[model samples]
Target: MPRRGNRLLVVGLVGAAALTSAMAVAALATGAEPVAAGVVCPNPVDELPAIPAGARIQVERELSALDQQVAEANERLVSTAGQGGPNFAQNAILGPLRDKRAATLERIAIAIGREADRPEGLEQFATCALLGEGEQPAPTTTTTARETTSTTAAPEQEQDDVAARIACPDPTGALPAVPQAARAEVERELANLDRQVEEANERLVSTRGQGGPNFVDNAILGPLESKRAAALDRIEIAIGRVSDQRPGGLESFAECSLG
Candidate 1:
């Protein structure tokens, strides 16, 4: 009976030793921070704080903004694609804008990926619905693209105008009158652009105000983005000139090719 009791004690000790080793392995594997040597095992979940709603919202919003930027950029590329005309300055200006926007997207992706060490975070957010989880039901691809177009079209219009204007409206030429068709197209595009901008602004406001996270990164960062903003301003001025009553020349109707 004493031998049997000793054998039972040995088995229990082995089991305890195994558990200890397993726990040690787990700690090392999961980067389990130790409170102290030979002391209490910390609760893993307690070690990390849940991402705050505000922070998450901000991060998510930034992620979306960057993604929207990328999409808009690609769209610009498409818009400018296959054109082999005198739009040399227009295309030239877009080069740097494209590169910078791409860089911004990369940085944003890196930030999203590092949150609490998540993987596929960049892609996740890129593919994630703009409104975040649940509120919109199934992930509708068509709706997302349409919404993206509607959201980004305005900023591009404004920025393109701003950029063109900043290039210093050609003092060499006088203000030209817009062609009838071009005028109609410009008006139509501007109206659509305005509607889309309003939609996007509304989305931004609603997203930020939600109990979710607040996206402050894009809250008027600085002039780096102003280059693009300038482009928008230039575009607006140019469009205004096109629609202007002044009779300068036919150059104002150059964009008539857009149609």
Candidate 2:
């Protein structure tokens, strides 16, 4: 009888140990924090905040409406380009459309907790470049012989002027540490700006001497220069806002490339 009682007690001890080991394994598998020796395993799902009622439906509706507006804007941009009026496509159509679309995208980012601002999603939905329409052609301008002579400059001098005008700011120490909440949207916008800079560079190279002597200056360089400047400015503002929120914020974002 004494031996049987001892055997039962040993078996009970083994069973308790096995149960504890199983609980620890389960916690680690589910990404839960390490449990203290005497603490019970926490429910990981309990850590997450509850989704607000109707939030998903509201976000979907807003996204759908924004997409419609973007489609209409693309149509208008193409139509204005086809009309062949100087500055009409850019100033009246594309500019306003880009502004509205960007604003809508920002709102969506804030609403859906920044996941919607990812590059893949923005490239698919927010970018106007994917609309399958060509850029407006530069309007023909008649130049007198004197005008041509006065306008033409040495290749080296032209390069120097371009280099001087588009001098990119050193964003190394200047970038603010983006909070986790705003990280997705800010990075998405920066990626978009980087793409624009790349496209501008490509356009500058491709359309160098295509339209006319002034084509490079009027159609390509001027607009691209403006865009690059604006992008850089906005990037600064975004970073600045984040830095203002916390100490050591600027230094924390060492990986960010503002160029």
> Candidate 2: deviation at residue 228, Å?
3.8
lDDT of 2 at 235: 58
> Model 1: how far is 188 from its true place, Å?
2.0
**lDDT assessment of candidate 1:** 0.32
TM-score of each: 0.22, 0.29
Tens-digit lDDT string for candidate 1 (21-56): 224433343344432222111111111122232234
Ten consecutive residues with minimal summed lDDT in candidate 2?
5-14
Tell me the TM-score of model 2: 0.29
Candidate maximizing TM-score: 2
Runs with alpha carbons beyond 4 Å of true place in candidate 2: 1-167, 170-172, 210-218, 229-259
Q: lDDT for each of the candidates?
A: 0.32, 0.39
Residue-wise C-alpha lDDT for candidate 2, range 18-110, written one tens digit per residue: 224334434343355554322111111111121122233444344455545545654565555557666665576556655665665555445
- The window of 10 residues in a row where model 1 has the poorest summed lDDT is 5-14
